[model samples]
Target: MLKKIFKQTIQINQIPKYFLASPKPNFPIDKIRNFNIIAHIDHGKSTLADRILEMTGTIVKGEQYLDKLQVEKERGITVKAQTAAMTYEYKGEKYLLNLIDTPGHVDFHYEVSRSMRSCSGSLLLVDACQGIQAQTLSNYEKAKDNGLKIIPVINKIDMPAAHPEEVAENMQLQFDVEKEDIHFISAKTGVGVDGVLRAVVEKLDPPKADINKPFKGFLIDSWFIKDQGVVMLVQVKDGCIAKGEQIMSCAFKKRYDIFEVGILNPEMTPQNSLTAGQVGYIFTNMKAVSDARVGDTFHKPDEEVEPEQGFQEARPMVFAGLYPDDPEDYMQLEKSIYKLALTDPAVHIYKESSAALGNGFRCGFLGLLHMDVFKQRLDDEYNLDCFLTTPSVPYRAKLRNSQKILEVENALMAPDDGLVEHYEEPLAEATILCPKEYVSAVMNLADERRGEQKEINIVDEKRFKLKYTFPLSEIITDFFDKLKSATQGYASLDYYHSGFREAKIKKLVILLMGEPVDSLSFMVHERRAHDFGKNICKKLKEKLPGQQFTVAIQAKLGSKIIAREEIPALRKNVTAKCYGGDYSRKKKLLERQKEGKKNMRSIGRVQIGKDTFVDILKN
Candidate 1:
């Protein structure tokens, strides 16, 4: 009887009547502030978000808040943009605040862009000690581009190295932000976070959306949930959407009946309707995952609205092959990739097969870190063992005979020399902001990577911004790491895609035992082809284990072998039994061993193990 009563009590507590039913609160549009927090990585973006949630009582003092993703917790950085709706009472008046905490890494700039579009204002947080960095300028520009009001805040003011006044001056000089408008606070200690929150309510203009118009919302982010179909986080720009309403996507031209409409109190809370100027989520009972896109527009079936402008489809800049370690798990890996792609629309993937690696997906990402994050999520979320090939950037090749151009993301897709003319590699305009002390080192590093200086602007006596245009292929691999190292972690870099430029690019192929491996081939600049071939050959020679017969590794440009290395066969002690015998006997034993080795080499085939492939790719 006691156990039954206890179980009943627990069940009752779990099912709140208010939570089960939809909430019907009508918030004035003029009183709602839809904004996001923007900052450089490790400049306390997440910490400040936590404080905002705490101050608004959206979450309790000790409750675990944003940075909810497991990978985010481990990395101590925000990977995805998370939304939370909070109601703050100031001077006896209640105001609804919709906050989006976005990732600071340059790789997730797309996420920042989408978040910026959904908001009317932003809190531009800067570190007091570190001052303004590269991403600070990049994110600020994005917010400004979206016409969002920016509130400058100096974070980490409690630290011993805190220089709030200096950072404020830098902001004033670099961004032309008025010094009087800047706020100084330590996000960790909640010193002045409340003031920042109140300022958000006072300074930023309320969302200017027409609630009387037809229901139309911008799908800022979306993902699939098990048993729930597709859920989209949308910012209502006009009118309202409610649970059980019929909605259609303007981009996909698909219709669905909404299963639920709710606000993210960090967790989805059922709401009767999300009115204009409010940000919330809608669950469509549609199983087709492709119907929902990040930047697509959704509206009621009876009311059609023009799709929002400035919403471009996310394009993948880096390409690689993702294969499972175990070939039998190919289908599982494919399913995992599909599921992950549903959540991350920026990641483009299609089926691919390799002779050595079996079936996999040809995956494309925004950048190197984006690729790594996708791979890491695959391992951590889906529990699949995956192997990734070397990353490459997309190139546009013009055909000589037909004058037709083809965009080739994979080297394997490139046409042979007989059909190809010249290749145009993608170029990106990169901006590096760093201290003056490390400018020379950064310049030298950029020069080594074939970067052409475009311009240089002095920020102040202590810092400056360097602009350069580089082949995306050159910096896609290790350029960021080198830049950080050269600047002693003080440099921050941002880049955007520029148009393609003609280049002397050649396909560098790696041949194992005389057979060319298509998976091992990559495109390289003609000037560095020899050095790239030599380096890869050396790395492969070290990675490939000794086989029964000598394995010859060669790097080739067309039919010409540019670099060659050999892995010696594992030798047995064939002459060990002749230790007590004469020198002639030992020579005879060695001769017999050599003859056997030669026989083995005649028909031997070198087998490249999975570890060898991983090592080569990692190097």
Candidate 2:
């Protein structure tokens, strides 16, 4: 049976060139090279990708071609990992090179690792002026763990501050590569780019595949379009996939017919079919975006092929409640979120409600930056106004008089303080890189956040790297911003989950007129609870409008109130209405007014506006 399939594949490859409707990829398996560009944020990965496309004649020298998302363009950062296929000729031999340009921000590290699974080699980029950064080391470790061929490249050599030799020496010492092995290039000016391209074709090993085997591939990404349904980006591993082929997703246990198959030659260009070792997109009749799961394995319906080692499922490290600005737009907001989820499967979404804020979805993300980008996309792509709550990390607590443990992702879900056992907060191991001049300041900042020193290493004469263990909650808050400020924007941070630790954790709830406002509640460490409560109470006092009766704003933990503030009532002059009346009549009227206010205070509800919640939560 395998022999028969091999003969048929050969026959298909032998078909006359003119007989095909579109140009088919006929390169031999040995001539194909699959690789990705990995680096830290602002290291010129996109600029390098542009130069590669121009050199291969796949695209003209123009705007950054791979960063197609509006948020990416506006923020000058790559959010999604983009793919491009190019035909490069060297020494009169044609080669097929598929390049996956991955994002460098720590929030999108999943994209970097996922792209690594589909390729065998990576160009680890570092800005010559910046040298090794926090994410550069992180990505290098990922590449090493995946057993990928790493070709170190120093970018931005054209800059006056670039220190190519110095950077290469550090890379050699850190990555254990020879001094001559590092390639220096100015991706912006296209200098020394040809050498890097040559290295890709010669140094990287071709993928091991057998076209005769059953069709098998992994769905790395998927998104929705207006005219079409879910468009899936697949990395074919073992066999060939063509239009009309029936494929089954192991995750869904359902089969669907392929409507179209093509390669991303920087665009959705349809072709005859995609064979083993090719990265391409496929269109199917399946309309439900939820069905298009990333990291799913697809194979021929009739064949029994073991699933390949797929991508690691993305775990959300921070969660926030997202509510539409207008209550009437709940359904529209739900639809919009689903659409975004199709593109970013890392987001965790579930319907949730709040007493202060109406209907909303509690969404989880990889980090603060990930949550910010998701929110920005909601506004830019869907043109929808949204209100986001304070982001928090998931916490673990033990139930009272029971061994059962509870995981609380939102403050409202936290168990009562009488729980028999103690609480544990998520821990993270952070890698910080900074100039030696600011080492003292960075260490002080980290120490203030309850960080424990793990190790420290000197990268060069002027720079050093530090590893510290911190509560995940701290890292998700303003830690990054504070780090940048302390180091004068010279420090970079990357972190990973490092289990959990026992801590004095409590649920801090906000109360208005003695009524708990669920939306304003959050979990905090006992040590920081007092400060957190006081700050929030002050904010509420400034934001809440004065009511007819005095409104008391209090932050309470368990049965104790930690902070309190009052919004003064709007004083109305009943005497003004009684103008020129007798003094006894005016006194009687004042007493009546006071009595009504006291009664109203007993029964009246505090009128909290949407704007007030938005203001407090955002801060």
Predicted model with the maximum TM-score: 2
For model 1, the stretches where C-alpha displacement exceeds 4 angstroms are 1-24, 512-514, 543-552, 566-607
Candidate 1 lDDT over residue span 53-100, tens digit each = 766656655524789777788788888899988887788888889999
Compared with the true structure, all predictions reach lDDT values of 0.83, 0.86
Expressed as tens digits, the lDDT of each residue in 1-619 for candidate 2 is 2233233322212223321122247557788899999998999999999888777777766789999988899898999989988888889988889999999998888888888988889999999998999999999999999999999999987788987888888998899998667877778766777778899999999987778888898887888777678899998888899998889988888889999999888888898789988889999987876787777889988997887664677788898989988899999999999888877778999999877678999999998888999999999989998878888899889776788988889888887777637888999989999999999999999888999999999998989999999999887878999999999999999988878888989889999899988878889998889999999999988887788889999999878999999988898988887768579999998999899999999999977887888888862
Task: After superposing candidate 2 on the true structure, give the runs of residues whose Cα lies further than 4 Å from its correct spot.
Answer: 1-26, 401-403, 545-551, 567-605
Q: Estimate each model's TM-score.
A: 0.88, 0.89
Residue 250 deviation, candidate 1, in Å?
Answer: 1.0
Q: How many backbone clashes are present in model 1? A: 0
RMSD of each: 7.7, 7.6
